[model samples]
Target: MVSLPSTLERIRTRLILLALFLMPWQTRWIFGTDTLSGGISEFGVLSFFVVEGLIVLAFVLQPFIEHHRDFDGAVTLGWVMMLAMLASVFSASNPHLAMMAWLHVLGAYVLFLNLLNRHVKPKEALFAFTLGLVAPALLGVFQAVTGSSPASTLLGLASHDAMTAGASVIETFSMRWLRAYGSFQHPNVFGGYLAVGLFAVFLFLRWDVSKKARMGAYAVGALLTATLVLTYSRSAWIAFVLSSVLAGWLLFLHHRVELRRVIPLGLIILFVMGFTATLFSNPYVVALEETHPGREVYAYQPVHNLYLLMLSELGVIGTLFVLLWMVLIDRYIFANLPRVGAVGALAIGSALFIIGFFDHYLWSLWPGLALVAFVLAMTLRLSEPGVEKE
Candidate 1:
């Protein structure tokens, strides 16, 4: 023996923690280009990511550590959705681009479902997640205060000038203030992450951690909040405020909800995902960037609504699978309302859904997908067996 750990389990554990921490933080990615623009257009496509690599590695090693087991029913449903997404690409203008996008989706879904089935402890997972956010908060604050963002290829950062045409900024009579991007593609995406991930700080409070940890949580919360405000993303702000208020009301003030009560939310999201199929849309919208070559298509914007975005890209067949996935997940959580983590999960999902109403990132962007994956994994804790009811 080389004196290494006897099993791959130890390596798997460390990889899991590292992946969780990095998944929600700033991503380190590089895009290879065959074009003159040096691949800005292929930012998401033809991209290699550090976190995605780690997740795939961990997933590959997973079978070695466990005994033969039946497929997790919930995870299987996610796979079905993935298959539908693939099937939807049959008619895409650029099926290759669609394939890459589908891979990104699969990575996110795998991350979500795998974390749900794992046996990680709450305190450890929470700490890894909450701390993962601190660096982004600090960097975002600096960018906002200075109104300058420097590019670093190694760090996967791109320069942002407040005076630039496409730069996200706040314009007032006094000056055009720069918004914090926080290593994300957009300020809104950054704000979305903070709004949802900031709750992890509070969730950790439930555990009896040390004084230092408690103070640290308070500090992290403050930092994230500062950056969130600087991002000036109204959608994120609304999502956070509304989700907190509603979850608090339903979880504490209201009586325990039965499964019947949660059914409507599922229908709502399902309806939204399929709603675009009922309306007319641009024929080439599904793979616009790839379909138009040698064009500055970054200026193009997708539909702001997540539902509309999904319907446009995924087609009716794919949208239906996603809707079914939502229905099943909703019914499951709602059935357990007032149980361990049901309300908390619902609140986070609601916040995300609300953000989708005003922003299309959760369905379109890689960073946004990573944000969802991290939150879903973290929040799945509440749904675990034996979580005490409030």
Candidate 2:
């Protein structure tokens, strides 16, 4: 029978998994939205505060109870990022909003780097990630097919009022289709989550798990990939293709696998690309071809690059800090790549960098930032001794 202490530990582990699983869903209370002019406004989410508080409590109590100590460069970078973000709040247009955003970053850092890596196993983390994608993936499929979803006030999910003929969807190819947003603020953000989940599922497949688990991973991957197509996020589509290739190549290098095995993965990516091209008439795709005017609050021409967005919003010094943090974390991951294996690191990093070059989700969305933290934690945990190797 389990001791009382062991039972309590088990409960803590389950809560950590639950928090990780809910990271992507934007069910929250919006105090205000950022204006085009880079004003920071308060945006409160009950789930964010609750989960983060629990993580912090667990982190603070763990040393006294469990007497465990582990430290790495990734963890150091995470703290640095939190500090940088807090400092940047002073110069933000809305200091209140900036402070709130910093809090969210803090939560992400603790949950992913502190709680997840230290307590959760790699397989458990992967299972949580795959489970997290299920609701959004299914919702995306439904939105694509029906062209709308009812707003759920309790869940904080908005309706599809913007997906009209000339607004979100395009009518150029004698057809119209709604882009999938899932429960996110935009279709592209949802696609970003799916892109990351795709890689996570790929990593899961390489694990020495049961046949049933492998099959489940395959099903999740398929659902995520299909919904990603419906999102019509050109940046995400391109990122997925590039990241999939990098992951396959890195796997081959790490395992000395035969080229034949990698070919099937490449073919699948090609098929996804082909399907994306069939939706060339999507307004989001068309928006890429033309120079659209920037929304009033943003104060710049409509540009997709995340670096540019950071520069515009955070200014040179803040942007430098942000970039430096990214570099440091990335360096830490690659430095330990031999231990962690390259598939997960390369796949997630490739997708983020590629999509980041063409989109601003990572810079502007709290959920996007959280996803990055989660990926980094999962990557670091997978590198530890006793974890499976590809």
Candidate 3:
């Protein structure tokens, strides 16, 4: 009888893994706009909601049926963030949209930190995440190389016209380059996703895995880095560089890796930067730069600054809530840095802080936000040395 229940629990854990793997590819359907034509677009994704339902159900069942109750500070902070979001909705210009946004963010936080963390091993969860990114990374590489992506439409992936006259293009001194959108609304968002995947690959490589597994991690890391470069997202580029340097420095300080090994990593960084600069010098990139200022926020001037965007959309109280959330994350990372490993802690921390500065994706985009939650969950899990099963 006990064995039967254990078997059922294992099955449930597998289902959770399947749902997490597919969450990134879930598509949304826009029902209506809050205003006649220009306000918040109300959207629904049945699969997303279904997955959230399952995660919440598992969380609820665990405490009662399994007699499990293990709550951490991260979970508490997440609930606090949810409450803040609820309060912010009252002052939101579009309360319905605000509520919906809160639900999405809360759902992601619960799915990763509460449910997935309880069921899966940290390494397994990280591997599943890296697997989920493979398809999108390949799509991005193909789009960048071919200058088009008809496959995105066939696969129901989100994409914009890269070759359109006024589309998303990067202009350099002499050329214009079409940025790879992959399965995201923007190249910057795609870049952010790849950056996280790259970090996962790095962690996989550092693990005491088989040689074949290490080689696979290397391949995946290279591909992800390539697509990240093709994204031409200045924010992502800056974030990756800063995060890598910080992580490397921490590794050295902790003596986790020898200083001599860091030299090759430094050379690789230089090579990547040099290659990206060459891409930026293309004629198309130059043309776009000369013609397009690349600042467009809902038809007005682009507010590239994330803090300002949060203030405008979420108001002062909501913005303060977000700032508080960031402070908590920083505290958690610093407090657990040694246990989490310098690479894991600094990589995720830098990505969140650096990317948050330039883009609203952390606040608005579901996939980007979900990645943040996943990284945080993984960091917390890694800080502890064993599987957190009850």
TM-score, one value per model: 0.80, 0.81, 0.81
In terms of TM-score, which candidate is stronger, 1 or 3?
3
Candidate 1's displacement at residue 185, Å, is: 1.0
- Candidate 1 weakest lDDT stretch, 10 residues: 276-285
TM-score of 1: 0.80
Ranking by lDDT: 1, 2, 3
For candidate 2, report its TM-score: 0.81
Candidate 1 lDDT at 154 equals 62
In model 2, the runs with Cα more than 4 Å from the true position are 1-8, 30-71, 161-167, 173-175, 254-303, 312-317, 337-340
Candidate 3 residue lDDT tens string, 9-32: 776666666656655563544444
lDDT, residue 78, model 2: 58
| Per-residue C-alpha lDDT of model 2 across residues 1-390, encoded as one tens digit per residue | 888766667767777778668765666555555553554322332234344655666555452232113345545655666676677789877676677767776766666654443456767777787788899889988887787877886665777843464335533434556678887878888888888888777666656678777666666766787788888777888888787777666666666553343354445645754675564445454543343445332222356788787788667766777677667656656766654344576677778888777777776667776777776666555554556642
Q: Give residue 179's lDDT in candidate 2 (0 to 100).
A: 79
Q: What lDDT tens digits, residue by residue, belong to model 1 across residues 231-306?
A: 7687887898788767767755554343333333324433532442232232122324345556553333456888
After superposing candidate 1 on the true structure, give the runs of residues whose Cα lies further than 4 Å from its correct spot.
Answer: 1-6, 24-44, 64-71, 254-302, 387-390
